[model samples]
Target: MNSKKRAWFVLGITIIINILCQEYFFTEQFINFNPGRHNILYSAPYFVIGGLLYLYRKEIHNWMNIIGGWMLLFCLVLNIGYFLLPISDLLGHSLFPLLIVFTAYHMYALGSDKKWLHNKIIDFLSGISMEIYLCHMVMFRVVERLHLENYISDSNLNYVVTSVLTICLAICFAYCVQRGLDKLLLKKIA
Candidate 1:
């Protein structure tokens, strides 16, 4: 397929996945385990921009600095609007995805000043991010199953604890996966 048509097809697939996700969020399974759904929702933007980035890599990288630079300013505007006018859902919800894409762009087309983003810690996390993504759902489901929410009594506190615990557990799982792969590769080298 032509590059133009290929990119369009990828984008079409992404949109369809997003629509299905919206429907799945309504199901009882997801409703009962909100953290499971929350982890998936948090993972969505990364995958979305990844597909889009793959399709638009050449063009995006070429002008990403400029585009992302403008987006950084636009982000400030949207954030301020959302902050002052918390009554509006449109900009508030919209800002999250916009910021995601903007950050993705800037990270890809890293400037000399953005050396921190290219560090080992972020690299380690990014390398195992997909593993973390998969592990978090299972961890969250277990948390929910344990009635952590009921014992906690406070909704906000439960949310924070659940999210933090799931994230930490996911990181541990990812680290194990990384170590396993490293061992396998070393054995193969020997």
Candidate 2:
């Protein structure tokens, strides 16, 4: 398969997964844990972009300083506004991911050299992020089952612990599932 086509396929699958998860899972779940208006889940797109950029570092690194600086600025502004003003949590968290996805899509889709995107790590993570997105809820349910929230009463501290555990668990589960999938598929071909 061609690199351009493959990238599109990954992007498409990501979009599809987002749509399904939102329609079925998030729509229901959002009501329960309505983090206000910041939409932290939007950050998922950046994780995708960050994974891709890590893989295509040669091409992306050139812009890392410039892009990184602007991203930082944007985040700082959002944080100040989030805390100082009566900004909604959903909007605060939503902004970063929207910025990231826009920046990444522009940087790679229109401007990047197609030849540089065949990096193995990016391709691998891009393919598996969908699964991570899908299974993340299971991990969240586990955390709740353990009553970990009972340990952290301060809202800020609770957010911090939950965020850390969510990311770590998602990565671990995704790695295990992807590795198993690769082995299963490779064995069939071999």
Candidate 3:
């Protein structure tokens, strides 16, 4: 199959798997594995969607330029409805993922061409984003171990402080790891 055909096939399969795992085969083990809405099954479809977006980005960009505003308004209405209305289980299961995709696509489309988003800090953060993801759980644990929550008296203030500290720690750790990997790769290449 062609690349486009293969991408569509994979996208379809992942979407089917996501719906099945979420709606039908959501067993206790699955629930345990995917605590606090961190469902691994959903990742597959989203990854595939991202790939598809990149694959057809030029076409998608043209289409977005034409009707992006209308789509954004539609998404806004759906989002309002989602929050205001008592959604049924089936709709909630389906609509939530759709909303996420729409929101992410709009964000990407809007930000991808912005000159202001091309700053040095943004570039550095983007470079280490994967590393940050890998190290964030450890940084969260470090924050908990340090008892940063109690460092502040007010509950909300403590939460905010700890959250900021955790993010800063995670970013620092990720930057160090990225630098180490770069040096190691450079040595191997040399």
Candidate 4:
């Protein structure tokens, strides 16, 4: 099977599912895929963008690729601004997935263009980003349950400490889990 075509088919299915869910295809008690983790249908659009980029991976060029040469400055500003604007929580949190789509391409562009831009830490983090995301949520939940947030009367420092601890522990846990999975699935098979 053509994987590219398969990607398109999956995108189509997700889009259809999202539309159906939005339109209330079924009763809530019977089968509701709205506003739930199970409803990953909306994320399909992001996947589609990535899939298209993957298929056209070889053809990716700089803004020279899009706007052509000589107007490089204009393209550079546009590209950088496109990614940087998403850093603000107002836009970032709201347009996160779309920003994520832009981010994927931005990373590719930056990594290819600059040497210092792509570091080992970034590589490692990107490799286990999904694990970090999954593990971090659990850690945050634990902190919330233990009333860690309410413990300290000092607002700023307490919040900072909790955030720092959460992130550090999350990275450690995610790394361990990734290593374990790697050994179990890869090393054993090999």
Candidate 5:
């Protein structure tokens, strides 16, 4: 299989499975599931992808190697930071999958030479990652602002409602704002 196609396949499958696990299994049914377990599962694909890239390092693009190096360094820092900060399951669990994404990107970017990835259009969409990162916090604030919490209890139904609301707002409002900002910034940067 072509490396690029393989990369996208791995990335897409990984994302879909992770989201399904979070939304359905972890949140809806197994509310008490240990986050650490899910983190490992989430990061598994990245490890495989990263290993493949490392094994085929010679065929990889130099820019990918450069980006992968940075991602590795970043994961190293995050790992160390987790160790020093007194490990919280929430933070550790969340960071693990991202570490995987960093690894996958390193592998994908290294294996392929696609300058369009760094082009203004793609860069703008990528910039929305920041918005995705902060969406939960923003969602929480919005929920609080509307005093929606007062009516909802910590039950399965409440979980569904909250998750649905958060996902919707995150996808709609937060992403939209992020895209707008990214476009504005792209014009200046590009």
Candidate 6:
């Protein structure tokens, strides 16, 4: 089979697996067995979807240009329906795979043409996103340990302040780690 055919096959299998995992396998026993949602079975489909998106990005971009507006409207309707309608948790959860894929596709297509999305802060954050993900939990723990919540009397304001401070600390830490890695790699190469 050709590469395109293989990709489609993999995508189909992953989507089925994702649906099955989300619908049936996400029980308390499964959660206990796979603590922190760290199981590859739970995340592999998303990684596959992301890979496929990148692989056919150009083709998808052209298709998006042709149907982007209609797609956006459809996604908006889905979002409104999902939020406003009194749907059962199981029904809503079942639709998650489709909803997430459509939302991600539309976001990519719509955001591609927006100049505001290319700002310096966005660029910097994107560069260090992986690092930020890696260290964010540690930063949150540090914030909690420091008892920063006591400084603000209002619970809501305290939550917001601590969240923002934690994110800022995480960003700084990620930036430092990235820079240090870059320097270390440069030194080894030189």
**Comparing 3 and 6 on TM-score, the stronger one:** 3
- Which parts of model 2 are misplaced by more than 4 Å? 1-68, 88-128
Error of 1 at 106 (Å): 7.7
Local distance difference test values of all predictions, in order: 0.64, 0.60, 0.71, 0.63, 0.63, 0.71
Weakest lDDT window of 10 consecutive positions for candidate 3: 29-38
Tens digits of per-residue lDDT, candidate 4, 106-167, equal: 43553254445468987888788789877886886666566765678788887788788878
Candidates 2 and 4 compared: the better one by TM-score is 4
Residue 83 lDDT, candidate 2, scale 0-100 = 60
Compared with the true structure, what per-residue lDDT tens digits does model 1 show for residues 82-108? 456544465444335554545554445
TM-score to native of every candidate shown:
0.62, 0.47, 0.62, 0.48, 0.33, 0.61
Across 96-142, the per-residue lDDT of candidate 2 in tens digits comes to: 44544455454543334345556786677667778788778777777
Off by over 4 Å in 4: 25-38, 61-111, 133-170, 180-190
Per-residue lDDT for 20-93 in model 5, tens only? 67666777367665564436555555655665566577766665556755655565776566556653666544
Ten residues in sequence with the least summed lDDT for candidate 4:
63-72
Clashing pairs in 5: 64-110
Error of 5 at 44 (Å): 3.6
- lDDT of candidate 1 vs native? 0.64
| Model 3 alpha-carbon miss at residue 170, Å | 4.2
Candidate 2 vs. truth: CA RMSD? Answer: 8.8
Error of 2 at 105 (Å): 12
Candidate 6 per-residue lDDT over residues 1-190, each given as its tens digit: 2366677788778767766876668667566564223456656666566656666778777776676467667667776776677657766454454547554654565436445658898888989989998898789789888886567789988889878988999999999999999999999999
- List the candidate 6 regions with Cα displacement exceeding 4 Å: 1-3, 22-24, 28-39, 66-74, 86-111, 130-170
RMSD of each: 5.1, 8.8, 4.8, 7.4, 15.3, 5.2
